[model samples]
Target: MRKIILSASVSLDGCFEGADGGLDWHLVDDELHTHFNDQLRGMSAFLMGRVNYELMARVWPDADADPSSSGPEAEFAGIWRETPKIVFSRTLDRAGPDATVMREVDPEAILELKRRPGGDMSIGGARLAARFRQHDLIDEYRVYVHPVILGRGRPLFEPSDDRKPLALAGTHTFGNGVVLLHYKSD
Candidate 1:
């Protein structure tokens, strides 16, 4: 079965975004972006929340067309456009080409998706990830920890009463002080 990997970048303090919803703290240099592209190129699909999908649609679709985009940015634009996407949202009326909007999370449906013949899926969006985590749907977590402490921002994980154990699969340290911590659900 293909795995559902929850991939995200967080600050040293575990915040994914700043207080004002700014991502300027994200240290996605060419090296890091290239690494992201390398990982995403093998994914079968992107499982994301409506907000995340809409945010991506607004930028990635035209990123490559912009002459100012870097090589990694241009490459990611292609990857984002070509890969199939599954958006979870009830309010979203429609999605663009190669995208599907589901009204809610169906554990059996997600399991069927995992059983399909293809590469593993990369899941994003904190709320959606939280739901997947609650359902025990995620197989792995790829948390990229950057070397900065955000005084305040939206945290990556919410308060949970349950204990979830994750085994360390591996780790990769980037040149830009970002570390990718790979953990598998136990």
Candidate 2:
């Protein structure tokens, strides 16, 4: 079965976003953007929350058309457009092509998707990832830790009473000050 990978970028202090809900602190330079494009290109699908999907849809869809967009940005635009996306939303009535809007996260249904023949799926959004973590559905985690410290903000992982063990699968430090920590559930 294909694995479910929860991929996200967090600060050194463990915050995913600042108190103002802005991700401007994320140091996604050309090298990191290209790395993201390369990594996400092989995914079977993206599972995300409505907020995450909408935020990406607003800019990525037309990014390639903009002349000012960098090579990596344009490449990522195409990759994002082609990839199948499943957005979890309570109020969303519909979604664009190659996308599905789910009212809730169903573990059985997600498991079925993983059983099918395909590459691994990537789950985005902290809240959605928390839900998947609650169900013990995530098989791997690709966390990119930035150099900054938010001090206070939304954390990458939600609070849980039970402790989960993860084995370090791999690690990479980019030219920028970001470090990728790949971990697999033990």
Instruction: Report per-prediction Cα RMSD to one decimal.
Output: 0.8, 0.8
Runs of candidate 1 exceeding 4 Å displacement: none
Candidate 1 residue 154 C-alpha distance from true site, Å:
1.2
On a 0 to 1 TM-score scale, where does candidate 2 land against the true structure? 0.98
Error of 2 at 8 (Å): 0.6
Q: Which sections of candidate 2 miss by over 4 Å? A: none
lDDT string, candidate 1, 1-117, tens digits: 999999999999999888998889889999999999999999999998999999999999879999999999999999998999999999988899889999899999999999999
lDDT of 2 by residue, 40-103 (tens): 9999999999999999999999899999999999999999999999999999999888789999
Error of 1 at 106 (Å): 1.1
Q: State candidate 1's TM-score.
A: 0.98
Model 2 residue pairs with clashes:
none
CA lDDT for candidate 1? 0.94
